[model samples]
Target chain A: MANDKSSMQLVANGILKENPIFRLALSMCPAVGISTTVMNGFMLGVAVLFVQVCSSLTISMVKKVIHPRIRIPTYTLTIATWVTVIDMVLAAYMPEAYAKMGIFVKLIVAFAIITMRLEMFACKEPVGASFWDGLGMGLGFMIGMMTIGLVRELLGSGAILGYDVLGFKPLLFFILPSAGFFVVGLMMAFFNYIELYYKRKKGFKS
Target chain B: MKNIITIIIRLTLSCLLAAFVMGIFFVMTSKAKKHNEHVNEEKVMYSLLGYKVGAPVPETVKLYAVYRYIVTDPAGKSIGYLVPTGQGAETGFSFIILDLDGKLIEQKPVTVTADDAAEAESRDKAIKAALGAGKEAVYADDKTIIVTDNGARTAYLLSGKFAGFKASISVMLALKTDFGIRGLAIVEHEEDPGLGAEIEKGYFKNQFIGKSFATLKTLDVVKEPLPDAYAKAMEGVKGEDGGKILEQYKDHAIYALTGATISSRAVTNGVKGTVAKFAYRINILDNVLKEQHIVVPF
Candidate 1:
């Protein structure tokens, strides 16, 4: 406890250093499914943001009572409850969008990333730190998925967020689920390249 | 005891704050959302009328009056009223507009935002086919003039333009009725992106051209005969006993999709149902007030 990092450090770590999708490779279920469209990706990001912030703060507050044997279930329940609230609100208001992203929204319950964060970071951190950390992680995941959607929309359909970029004739394969894998792989590789460039410039030995 | 109370208060306060913020967000976005929905409804109405005229923005002005004038056949009989109906298709709510005479005015293309890549591609293909076949028409970008459906038949309507993702199919019969579809735009749907979503394709919509109500009712790829009421009406025309009613829909038969029976049926029935409902209203026109007829010059 004496040697622990600051609250700001925890927040920064979640956003970049310990990013949930790119760095830690978690929550791939929704990440892959909703990444097909920018609208779906954006909404799913908001849902994750809500879940991460609420669950992190709850788990931190209840960390003292949670026994090792029951910790995972408790964390999952907390996450699921937050997801359900967002899901209901979306269904009632944005029925069109909610209808399109159905089933995948409900599957937020089994997202292992939320539980992993609760166990690894939130339990030991202060509530304030945990909340910020969770927010950063959720944002990072959102950015990753949205980036993929943006690329797929632009390349596959020749549009980004409905704005046509390339000639109207688009490469149709870019929007397919199989295409998602190729784009993700290339994106992950790009992220690695950026990380390596900064490390090399800083003269860090591997 | 004090610490326990403090923790409970903190949790409650946080939850309440989140809820309050979300509530405020809803209030702020509600008006714009409602306007978007209203615009979509008008687009649906315009698609079925089968004639291409540009749609006005729904948010700025409400459509207080929308009606179809039934054009009888050479025998001088009244047909059904043409009205618009929305249906679930690949991209969202693709529409088929019809009037009482069993004449399909037009089909409106699917309206989509560029967000969903799969829907966009499918919608584009559908619109292209509809226009290329001269089954639909649209207001071309950079040109204020209303181009014929032939303009769309060769090139994509939404080809180079990007703003709001929308597809509309408009049909025009030789009959000189001013009442026609203004647009058909989809609001929402989860049709299989490529294949099942082909309903938005204009070719499927164009097949309804020149289909009479009697024939549409008995519409089968197998070329079945009309149902009892419709056959009787046809017989009345041929027997020289029927006057106005038999001639109204004698030429309009509903067309059926070969592969997508249910989807085609849904659209065909929707057209028939709307026309029937509107015709019923027109029959009791004395009871239906024209809300926009009161012209107040300020």
Candidate 2:
């Protein structure tokens, strides 16, 4: 109902305010599974971004005709199609990444974050707005995953993007899945703190 | 209601469009994907055979089992078999050990968890204990792959995997016709790219070349630099000390990656298990071949 903001704002909001990982807490499995390294995170994020954008655009353009009762199935099928296309493209052009992430790419068809956006945002918003929202959310997710990957790789393996910098691991826990929760928690807290500080400086409720 | 029918039509139309697009993509990529995997398999086979790029690969027939490739020369003489790759427990593999005439000592299921191979019990010792004496080795299954070439039945290509620092690392080992370790390839791995991933490089794999299963079975991952003796031998100029160094480690040593002890050890354990399994299978094959009066060259 509130569609007054520019497309840029919608995209920005997904990154800063409604980030699927840090803000909304959707699709944590992939966010953690592939976040073992910055490169892994970056690659997965790029993939999700493409699927999310394509699915969102498809859903938004067809919203008027989608019967509410059958909407979930329609959107799911839509996302699966896009994911398949992306997987084929990757296999054709980027054999290395295709090999590394072939399974995960197929799994993206079922990613909750992509589905949730189709249901909640794209169905309600216009096509252009939904496209921006998907892009923003996808970018925000990529950044969040990259952040987790950087910390984990640097501490768990003493490397970043697979390159050794520290010469030794500092904390192995950070790279494991359990520690992934902590990275997300810490980032959430940091962002929340920043928001609260700004709120207080503006004389608003913290 | 008419609304229900309308929704059905919309869903059907959308699905149709999506299917059309995906169908086009499938047509474009399916052939290439299958072909790529086939070429890779051929390459792995040739590398194991030490064949040159343009050299002819023996003709092949399918042997259905856990693994699928069986090779024969142009004259229809037996060459070898190719073991299919698979995940066993957790680490990667598809390998093995032995003398031309020696029977497999035994096969034991070895778990290489950090706890089992941890302090006091050297990882190799723990492995020895697991495999020692009367532990009955499991029969050949999908996890272990062996290629029994007729030229030298003692030789084989064995593959295995292990949990590395970050992810699973898969390796292929080529045993020469004379029971010598020949070529090595890291088929797949998800280790940290630059640091842990060095396992795929020439230097690491080359270590296995010229080494044999007997020596590798007792190998330990030493953290120190290559000793002067071994260093000398490695420099292609073997002095007396270098020969002594080689002698010392010939049956038991591997240098850990500069910063990847965990991954290095994992690879060692995975390869060790594979050799053990291969040796056992070769022994079985040798018995059968002997009854048939087949000769495996030394």
Candidate 3:
């Protein structure tokens, strides 16, 4: 599926067509859980991006040596190693950011998006292609999180990235976990609508 | 058999390599991580003492840490407290040995090397030596910090922990010499954001300031809506205005957060208990010092 596509197309595909959160519905836990604020979403997004890219690269490079029976364990180990290294480095160098993202950083290992990419794409692709795929998927997830965060933060608290934008909360419910489902569901429908419009324009049947 | 063996060997090697890489990073960053934590702690301590971040702490404003330890017998029965004299000692550690009834037994200084101070084992060894046989000093989780601004006792900082909505919330409070709260900082908590987490907001925390120990003992978390004017003032009032605003509400109980009364009550109760215990403990310590005629530098 990835052989005919150029690297840029692979990235665009991840961002729009096969978007982790919006389209593919992967890693919904964090997308719903931490997307209460733009900063949280952005921070978790950056951490996940770093881990995803590193894990994908490592798996692709070592795929030749890893036994088929043990590839899942190997992939798990690679993801865990990158997450720990990032967690420690952030704690040491960027403590303020770490304070916000610390809990989420460790949880990235359990994220289905990273592991799924490794299994479906990274392990089968060449090193360079796997790197591009990882980057695209990571960026897609980051964008998805930030989009959810933006809507939640603005509506719930009447703030944007912690800055008081509306001076008064429009809907306190938006900040709650329940609101996350509503936003994600509405966003999915909106994206699906756009996709349907484009498909129809290209004379494609539903 | 050969294929299975290869698979096992490959899996083991991959695990080993991952562990090795993680170990390298952990060892390399452990020191820096510790340093960062120490700095963050000091920053919190200083901020609670009304010092601004990024600015150097003034020489005149000194903070002396008084480590408190409960001296226990071999059977784990509590005996007494081994407290530092806080004499501004430049060398060695000076401790005031007190019996269970707060009777002064002896004042002794344990000469511990700089290297030995970092390790708990060596420090325990020194403490054991000073404490004599059959008694051991167990470090208390709470810390009592004396803040002196130009040799005058300005504030007493105490660390306290209380049960919150999800987990224990650790808070550091700075109290005036008269036992009125000067300021407070939430050191750590895992409360739910946008609900119980509002306890960390300045509007919520600043209300505790200027509340005397007497007021604090009886302080309640009121479910009534917080007045808009007072809320705005509590958000960012300073100097005489802030003092006046706080004084006006000095007798007022804490206003519970909209959806976080449990957390709000937790902090109010925690502060009250912490201050009550500190006041009681400090009174005893003061009496001991006065009886012993030991002059605490701060």
Q: Each prediction's TM-score against the native?
A: 0.51, 0.67, 0.93
Model 2: residues with Cα > 4 Å off, grouped in runs: B1-10, B38-170, B189-210, B216-248, B253-298
Model 1, residue B134: distance off in Å is: 57
> B100-138, model 1: which lDDT tens digit per residue?
443444444434333321233454454444334523322
1 versus 2: better DockQ goes to:
2
Ranking by TM-score: 3, 2, 1
Q: Is the docking of candidate 2 incorrect, acceptable, medium or high quality?
A: acceptable
Error of 1 at A54 (Å): 1.0
The digit string of per-residue lDDT tens for model 3 on B17-131 reads: 9999999999999999989988898888888877799888888887666667777775544424334344556434666666666677667776666456445678668878876
> Residue by residue across A122-178, what tens digits does model 3's lDDT show?
998898888888999999999999999999999998999889989998888998888
lDDT of 2 at B128: 40
lDDT of 1 by residue, A1-206 (tens): 43277767766777788877778878776676668767768878778878888889888997876655556656766776677667766765676677567677788878877888888878988888788788888887778778888887777667777666786736667766778778887888888899999999999963
For model 2, how does the per-residue alpha-carbon lDDT over A44-92 read when each residue is reduced to its tens digit?
9999999999999989998887888898899889999999999998887
TM-score of chain B of 2: 0.59
Q: Chain B alone, TM-score of each model?
A: 0.38, 0.59, 0.87
Per residue, candidate 2 scores C-alpha lDDT tens digits across B1-298 of: 8987887788789889999999999999888876776677668756666776788655441111222112222333221211122232443212122223433322224444433322223534543444456332232223223444442233466667667776777787877655567677888897754356767765455556677767776767888765545555654474757555555655557777766778778887777776777666555555644554432232
